[model samples]
Target: MTHNTDLPDVVPIFPLPGALLLPRARLPLHLFEPRYLAMLDDALKTPQRLIGMIQPNKVPGRSGSGLHTIGCVGRVTQFSETEGGRYMITLAGVSRFRLIEEVEGFTPYRRARVSWAGFERDQGPEEGDTAFDRGAFLQTLSQYFDSQDLQTDWDSLKEADDELLINSLSMLLGFEPEDKQALLEAPCLSTRRETLMTLIEFAMRGGDGEGMLQ
Candidate 1:
């Protein structure tokens, strides 16, 4: 038999600039700031160490402005102590959420009331087979990597599963902020793949093959 636990009433928050997380994916974070150290402590004390990962326009002290309405919630699945009381942690994406409202009267870190509606909807590629222009896609990726003079294990790349291939390529390509948002919000893996190709073509034509390398 299986049982379900009521969702936790508390949500922890973490904001990053220009970073995104897909469902079931993982993000590694280094927590050293005093505010975030407090967050880590709160999470460690709670049964659910859930944090909302958002992208800020600038680092906290620099600007603390421009945040996306959508973000992913993740749990600190792994944590370890580091020098100087810092923390190294890996957060596994649980779901995407929409910022409902910002709440005050809490800890130093920013807090928000969020909802995960439409998060688990039909957003991934169809189970089983995802059709794509494999030959053309590989050719484009190879040429792009080559033009950038970046070394990649072709064999490993070839062997990479579709999710890994798409997400990795998406990250490597330095797409504009809006473009990255579109890719993350794409309806399915195949659609995301298509967007990736479009970005690659744009890069190739603009002599921006190195953009992805950085």
Candidate 2:
């Protein structure tokens, strides 16, 4: 378990669009790019084995390739080297950090100094959503999945608790990058659940929805 004092001030960042990692959630990544492979190598040497997962802001004319202000820091909990020099790793999210500044360095990947001031709760235990409407949410999800031609284990989703169901959907859904960011930046579990519900409802009503398990 990671505590507030255990986190580092600066860490390596991987800017991937549409990839969201919330606290207590897991993100699996495939690293074949040379720069990211190097980044993984360096991260493994650190005591925390932490890496920042952020999305590249797609808005035009923004600097530093337009990184979002907030990103989640995750520890490399699972790692395996594959054939063709590729790496597969699963990151267990620790906390959300505000990007203070991008550090200039010779390393192939980007690093940032982050502030964890507002997200101390992320280092604590899983949160419960008192206002979650699981029945309605699942109904909407079923409709959306039908529209997208997607499939999933409904039994497992029904069995998952509020945090796991909401967070997992927020991570796995095919919403836009900005929508995913909104979910990530949400202040709490209930807000994220609301945002997720809205996104799904919007997608069902002719929004640009794509990507799902078929």
Best by TM-score: 2
lDDT of 1 by residue, 138-205 (tens): 89988877766777888887887777778667755666655666666766778888888877787778
RMSD of each: 4.9, 3.3
**What is the alpha-carbon lDDT for the whole of candidate 1?**
0.69
Least lDDT summed over 10 consecutive residues: which range in candidate 2? 205-214
Q: Note the Cα lDDT for every prediction shown.
A: 0.69, 0.90
Candidate 2 has an lDDT of: 0.90
Each candidate structure's count of clashing pairs: 0, 0
TM-score of each: 0.80, 0.95
Q: Give stretches of model 2 more than 4 Å off.
A: 61-65, 209-214
* Candidate 1 segments whose C-alpha is farther than 4 A from its true place: 1-10, 57-65, 122-129, 207-214
